[model samples]
Target chain A: MKTVSLAEMKTGQSGRVKKIYGGRGMVARLQALGLYPGKEVTKLSAFFQKGPVVVEIDRSRVAMGYGRASRIFVEVGE
Target chain B: MKMSPKPKRMVLAGNPNVGKSVLFSQLTGARVVISNYPGTTVEFTRGKLQAKGQAWEVLDAPGTYSLEPTCRAEEVAANLVNSADVVVNVIDATNLERNLYLTSQLLERGVPLVIVLNLIDEAAQKGVKLNVPRLQELLGVPVIPTVAISGRGLPELVAALPKAGRGRGEARSPDERWIWIGSVVKQVQRVTRRRRTWLEALELASIQPLTGIPIAALGLYLVFKVIIGCGQWLEGLLENYFFEPFYLPLLQSLSRFLGDGSFWHGLLIGNLPGGQIHLEESMGLLSTGIYAVFGIVLPYLVMFYLVLGFLEDCGYLPRLAVMSDRMMHRLGLHGFAVIPTLLGFGCNVPAVLAARNLESRRERLIVSAMLAVAVPCAAQMSMIIGLVGRRGGAYLGVIIAMLFLIWVAIGLFLDRVLPGYTPSMIVEIPPYRWPSLKAQAQKLGMRLQHFLTEALPFIFGGILLINLLHLVGVIDLLAGAFAPVFRSLLGLPKEAVSTLLVGFLRKDVAVAMLIPLGLTAKQFVVGATVLATYFPCAAAFAVLVKELGVKDMAFVAGIMLTVSTAAGTALNLLLDTVLPAPMLALFLLGLAVVLIAFCGGSSDRRESRKFTLTKERRV
Candidate 1:
């Protein structure tokens, strides 16, 4: 199945970033953060509307944008 | 210069943005060499001074928080503190509690410490009163209340400098320091429940993420308009007054007298068909390069530095960091990254170095890469203003809009791809005050001095190199080889191929080279924007390589090359499809959406992760 929103994924979920939707500045920003696909990610938190969401990928803790989380497609880890 | 017998040495250490520089200047009559710290490129200045008839060497280390060093500046500061005979711990008088933490760390190391209570006047004006003598007694160190900008208490500071020794300074550990600070504050500082004034309200408003970002945008816009407009006006004046009326005629007559066939004539008069220098139109070394440097780049750089120094001295930059923290969080970095971004505006060399303050290597690499690729320094921006803004105000708006979009895109991308813990933001909001004119002027002069001393030589060398290349026919050969790529990939003229070749040496000079071509407004915008984002100047590149290591620097260079070429090529295609007005409007709209989406997504993801962790804990 195709990956769905990060919000829908479980704690051990992983996914490849499919498409980045933004203009020149926006895409460049996303790319800089290492969001481009083919990388594995695991969710660490998901609670309040505006709280810290921790994700581990590339041996580093990455905090994602709220909208970015919603837009992201993740596949659950086996 | 020979020094007197047995010269004294003192190392200056403090939190970033403290008036350590101002204090150092007051103490040292000698010029301080200012640039970013090694490893991380934040600027530091070192100088020599004569105090009590004894010559002393003052090493001003970049701001560090504690002795247990995390960032590059901290490592350097710690090293200096360990080695120096005396450590002058300059503390911002307003943020005594936070500033004292570093002092505590210094005391722990058992260094000879002198606490310069800087910005005392501003603290008092803000209604924060401090009993300096009482505090000094408590800390078991000599505490000098200094209005460093005005040289107040400088004599006392000098007098007490020599008596420095390793003493059991009271605040040796973090807990002990805070406890002592609390007790001392109770005794010396009076806290009144004063209502917020309009200005305080304004200050608070400025730090609110929503309000602050817009304010930052507006501030940037105003700065660009003023600096760019001033540069153009001066350029016209210099052209008409100095070149057209005087230098052109003199050069022409000299060329004729020298009988054009000589090598000096070729070198001096260049390859003009008539072998005469028409200074107004001719791009001669003396006329063009000097005109470009003085008339164009210097004015803008000076003006930009003046405003930047004022903002820095006024203690607004830290507050700006606090305000931008929310947005920075979206990029997997802390608020302090804003410091690098601000420095990047002046020059990326120092900006990339300043990135060392970030908590993790990942954040540093991301910031360094972004700065190199996206941020255009004062010199490059000045040229952009000349080319783009000269067309009309609308074109100027589009270029800015494009830059904003690029910043947002890069930040968002980096946030997701790079793996690093985003440091929790803990910024001290320094008291707002009017910047001292003397201090501002000194800072401006220091920055300009570095630019002139370092960059000017390279600029001249670059010109000479280009001349040699052209004379030896290498330029023609290279231009031909690169012509297909230039036309298809970058949509620039083959002559522009040479400009690109020289761009790595000095961006301002490269852009100036394009002036002779008389490209249309759209072409100018595309070319300038791409160049601004393409590659950092040679100095900045060297700093990046040193700070980030050769492997990472190579990676960053690859990214910059690819992005700039692709963006420039894409822009050329898009320009043909859309009319100027609609294209600009669409671009701005797209940029806003991108920024919002990027910011919103990262924050939301962070929140969601936190939520699950809390839920797991409850379970």
Candidate 2:
């Protein structure tokens, strides 16, 4: 298992959320959208290198800004 | 004898982008605009529903992911659930696990609940099947599977409403709730591998930058072509077929009956210059006012709303939002800002209302201010075209380009100056669906109805007010007062002052007023561009004042006044000397470079500091 920020995850890579590095509000907001720790997520696409990232979580696609995406740590299998 | 019981308050709550709105419309038969993206319904809509002789007040609340509100729209949803006698928790069947999170929250609230599994057909197509009876047993609530768009399962839904009962009301922490949800899903849901659909491929293509950018360009081009081309065609048809042939003769006879010089005649038919009534130049309430509203504005409004409705329903708007995220970030906004900006093109009133979707006050203020100053609604755009398009297409192009530059400049300037950093966008991109013709038509109908009822009277009153001011000599007094600014700064004739004064009331009417001035091409471009930038029209002004509060509205007004004057003066100076085309291009490019460099450098430092501050707060 390798840990990386969500922003570093390659497209189509699936990962288990390890930790979220942000304020309590940010973590709660993500949790509400079903992006809590231990949940699985797949990087669907990134618009550009530094643009927002799109990820699929529980069969729904969510687009997160680059900064927010960078704060999410996920564990990926090699 | 018994007192009638108060109507039960039924609130529809759910995760964003589910079919709550569709279900609300079906249940109440109230046609509110339903779109494919989240935050489409920013405010709750109330409608009356009578089922089995029991009166119910049905409210379609703004969609939210949880009862713990994250933004303004979510706060509205959270507040609404409290008053709901029975809450219908709509869940997207295809996204059961994510949706159930909200359902669990609702369950914890212990409100009378009915679980609606919507989009069942789409889930089936994706090889997801639910044992609804088992799901109901596990959740301890009545569950109804529904296809909201098709109106299937609606009867059963209504029948099950009376059976709604509070589920297990045990309060659970976020982690505990997820564990419970997992157990429930494991028992009642099945997912089998299936072939990816073409729509899935298209969805992937639309978010990848290489294809998405080109697709975005083509999509926007088509939208504009449809709006402008079809709008003009309809306008011509209305004028040539209906207004010119039938309405003019009747008005002329009325002019004769009222005795051409009478007060009522002037008020209704306007001045007969050379014994002819000019629809565009006539300032009468009935002549120019009716022609402006129905003849010119209505056609364009219809087309704009139709295309906008299509974009909203087909789920292309969210994709557009995602594509524009990078560009928007430069302006201190996220992708969601595009929604209000696009709505501003149709009308600023709804645009101001739509700004509620943004998470911060600073973002809302910036959008509102920029919209007021730079964006011209369809009505004004049509009039501008009529006023300037005849000069040359290039002249109109210059005016549009100038507005775009101003829009960007205002965005950048506000981002740097505003106190807080823009909240990052965390939005869901719903899969593109085939837009329903019925829903599109309904949305179009609602917008047209709003326009006719709200705007038609304002136009007539403005014309009457203008005519009254002209008769009372107030117009000449105001014109004399502002004449120096028009003559010196704008290079417009003294008579053009009246149009600017009328501009505050209605932009289209003000541009139409420019018709009789017969200004030079340069003056025409300056006048049209200045009119668009000067201020929001009366209808839009009212909405802005309500949305932005008094102080921010004043600030926005100040920006409008300053920007319009600067734009007018710059255009006049540039156009008067007729600089070479390449020189003009170079000058504009230089200005853009300077503006970007000045704003970008400081903002980048401020943004990093903000991130660190947030991190400290978290610790």
Candidate 3:
């Protein structure tokens, strides 16, 4: 079991949400969009290192900025 | 019958990227800006609706992920929900799990709700379906499945307005609401996964870097070719048939009636260079004014929206926002900033309005200045292309390079000075689908109408003002006043002073006016670039004021004047001696790439490493 921030995921990789940054409020905000712990999110494309990463979660695509995306810890591999 | 002065108010609320704006436009028969991407509608748009013997004033509230506000716009949305009499909660059928989170919040507020399950067509295509009646029963509100973009189920949604009711359950905590929504979705909705289609594959390909960049280049090239080809074809037809047979005769008759060569005739028909009437080139309200709007620019405006509508409806825009994100970050905005910049290519009026989607005041200022200074609207771009394209593609290329360099420079400077904001992109990219024809036509009609009502007046009014200035001899005085700067700074002729001044009113007309000055190719390119970037048109000016406020607009104006003047002067003095246009384009593009890589490349890795170290310590 390997863990990496979403920002570090290569294009076409898949991972499940392991942890999110900040407190209950931040985690709640991420949960509202289905990015809670254990949700499977596939990295569709990670725009360079400084850009937002595009990921597909529960069949919906979302883009998160570098600062936020880097904070979203993910468990890689099925 | 005493008509109550107070109208029944209903606010349409939804999560971002749902079709609330489409539903708003369909019911009210008024157009609102709709983008496939989230956060497109930043402000409330009000329209009146008459249905079911009750007149309701509908407010389209900005989209929110939840009632709990995360950003400034969402705070406005939360307030709207509290004040609204009845809230029409629009939900995306395809993403029920995500959308119902907001619906549950609305339901908890005790506001009467009518759930419009929008984009049901897309949901169906994806093999997802909702039992509308069952959902209505569970939520204790009327649920109507709607294909909003095409106006389908709108009548049913309207009729269900009277059936709006509070849900069976009381308010709960955020965690409880999520669990409750999950149960509701499971009970009433069905999702059956299907094999991927070619469209789905193509959508994926567009996001991946190996394929998307080439596709974007080809797509943009095609868009430009179509706009130019269509505009020129229409221009030739109108000039040959309408101008030669109809418009010229009418102007000639007016010349006789108003006493030809009189002050009135001169004001109405312009100087008529050698007593010849040319519709496209004439400086008159009756001749060139009508010609420029209807003949020269109108065709391309139609084509651009057609292309734009397709791109938006098919959900390619947010993907573009994703792809352009890194580049935009280097320019000091989130990738979503490209959305407004792209819109600026159509017309800066709406583009300025769209800048509201940016996250912060500083972001708004940057995008507005970028649009006004670096990007030329379709009408302005068309004129530049028509004039410069004849000289050489490279000549056009040089002007673009100069503008691009200035655009990057201004962005870098602003990103440094303007502190306290630069939120990273966090966009929801909708899956691509085929655009609906009926919806596309309706959307196109709305944009064209907006352009006509909002922009045409400014163009016509500008010509009238310029004509009055000419009649009063103010033109000569001002031209003389500005000649030294025009000549020494931009290396353009004295007559170009008036041409550039007219840019304040209408840029396309200003560029077209340059043709009569008989400037060389270098002067023409330099003059056109300066006019395009110097200031926004009157229509765009009004919008920038409303969107950014007076203080911010003044700041933006300062930036525009300084950057445009400096760029124009530099281009005039150094362009010929510099590498030819093609090489210059390549050189500037390479320089931009290198600069961005240097600035964004090294600093970010260090910042992220430090960020992670701090997080590790905290953990």
- How much is the lDDT of residue B551 in candidate 1? 95
TM-score-superior candidate, 2 or 3: 2
Candidate 3 RMSD to the real structure:
2.8
Q: Per-candidate DockQ versus the true complex? A: 0.03, 0.79, 0.65
For model 3 chain B, where is the 10-residue window of minimal lDDT?
A: B599-608
* Alpha-carbon lDDT, every model: 0.68, 0.86, 0.80
Q: Pick the TM-score winner.
A: 2
**Model 3 lDDT tens row, B249-273:** 9887886687656776766776677
List the candidate 1 regions with Cα displacement exceeding 4 Å. A1-78, B1-4, B31-44, B169-173, B191-198, B209-214, B259-262, B273-281, B396-398, B581-592, B595-611
Candidate 2: the clashing residue pairs are none
**Candidates 1 and 2, the one with greater DockQ:** 2
Please give each candidate's TM-score. Answer: 0.80, 0.96, 0.92
lDDT of 1 at B13: 89
The predicted structure with the larger lDDT, 1 or 3, is 3
Clashes of 1: 63
Residue-by-residue lDDT tens digits, candidate 2, B166-270: 977889999998898899999999999898889989999999888999999999999878887898899889989999999999888888899888889888888
